[model samples]
Target: FRLAHISDVHLGPLPGVTYRELASKRVVGYVNWQRNRRRHMHDAVIDTIVADLKASQPDHLAVTGDLVNLALDGEIEMARHWLETLGSPDDVSVVP
Candidate 1:
């Protein structure tokens, strides 16, 4: 049986943030995202990986942590949607 392992998706198109949301550690994270992380991590790359994994028909998929950046509620929700698109929770084990 095939088992696929994926991690650190850092899924993005980060949700709109208000100044209030950037009040604490988020400020640091937001700056990092804006300055560096955003350019390197692309949704298209994740899509391509998902497509390839699906085509390979893995029997089980294991996803580790760091699925989202800043850990915002919206990011969690979006990651949930993205995970569903990849596979059911039963088929894909998620740790983040």
Candidate 2:
């Protein structure tokens, strides 16, 4: 069977994060994403990758960690939606 493994997606343009939410260890992640990740992360690149992967039509897709930058509720939901776009749960296995 063919398996595609993708990790460190780090999809950005983070959600409207608040100071309260970044009150702990998340502060560092929030700061890093705001300062560094946002500039480099591109949805177009991700889309192109998804399109290519779909074209390949692997039997299964295994997605590892780093789906979110800040681990916020919105980020999780965003990850969920992104995951849905990939395939059904039966076809995709996530380690995040």
By TM-score, who's the top model here? 2
Which portions of model 2 miss their true places by more than 4 Å?
Answer: none
- The whole-model lDDT of each prediction reads 0.87, 0.87
**What TM-score, over all chains together, does every model reach?**
0.91, 0.92
lDDT (C-alpha) at residue 66 in model 1: 90
Tens digits of per-residue lDDT for model 2, 1-96: 888888888986688988899998999998788788887776987888878887888999988979989889998989889999999999999997
lDDT per residue, candidate 1, 1-96, as tens digits? 899988888998799988988888989988889998899877988889888888998999998879988888899899889888887778989887
Off by over 4 Å in 1: none
**Candidate 2 lDDT for residue 1:** 85
Q: Which ten residues in a row have the lowest lDDT in candidate 2?
A: 33-42
